[model samples]
Target: MGWLSTIIVGFIVGVLAKLLHPGNDKLGFIMTTLLGIAGAALAGFVGEALGWYAVGEAAGWIASTVFAIIILAVYTRVIRKR
Candidate 1:
């Protein structure tokens, strides 16, 4: 996918992940987009390592969302402890 498409899909994935995860995560639009992109990248990396996906392939929605949620949890914890 192109950069623009990746950004668009990342935005949607971020929004979906925020909605699916309970609790208030007061994040702005830019932060959410960044989170989604990072999450997707993380998922893609792990999936590739596990032989679930090949290099240069985008991670699926479910995997992206799951990774995003995991990132969110980690972010919340770190922020809380700071």
Candidate 2:
């Protein structure tokens, strides 16, 4: 996908992640988008390493969501402590 498409998908994924995760994260638009992009990147890397996806392949929604949730958890932990 193109960069624009990726950004759009990342935004959607981020929104979903925020919704799926319990509690209010208080993240703004840019942070949420970055969170989603980071989650997608994490899922893609792990999937590729495990041979579940080929190079340049995008991660599926489930994997992206799962990764996003994990990221959100970490973000909450680290940010809330500050």
Candidate 3:
């Protein structure tokens, strides 16, 4: 159940990130989901480091989406160079 929820949330976050980001990156469903998961993970670490929020907070969703966009940016850059 936890894993299922994570995937669903990741998909939502990834879609949001893709829609919100300025530039475009060619990504499949799995890749997009992965981007979201990675971004959320990154945001979790950053939030903890900066003391912006607590673990498992709903506020983390916004940060997660933002971080997903950032990751999307970097992913596009790297892919473009390849």
Per-candidate TM-score against the hidden true structure: 0.86, 0.87, 0.88
Candidate 2 regions with alpha-carbon error over 4 angstroms: 54-59
Candidate number that wins on lDDT, 2 or 3: 3
**C-alpha root-mean-square deviation, each candidate:** 2.3, 2.2, 1.3
For model 1, how does the per-residue alpha-carbon lDDT over 1-82 read when each residue is reduced to its tens digit? 6999889878887898899888888999998998899888888888877888675555466788899999998998888898
Writing each residue's lDDT as its tens digit, candidate 2 over 1-82 gives: 6898878878888999999999989999998998888888888888878878665545566677789999999999998899
Give the C-alpha miss distance for residue 55 in model 1, angstroms.
7.4
- Lowest lDDT 10-residue stretch of candidate 1: 53-62
Sort order, lDDT high to low: 3, 2, 1
In the predicted model 3, the residue pairs found to clash are none
Candidate 2 has which clashing residue pairs, if any? Answer: none
TM-score: the better of candidates 1 and 2: 2
User: Each prediction's Cα lDDT score?
Assistant: 0.85, 0.85, 0.89
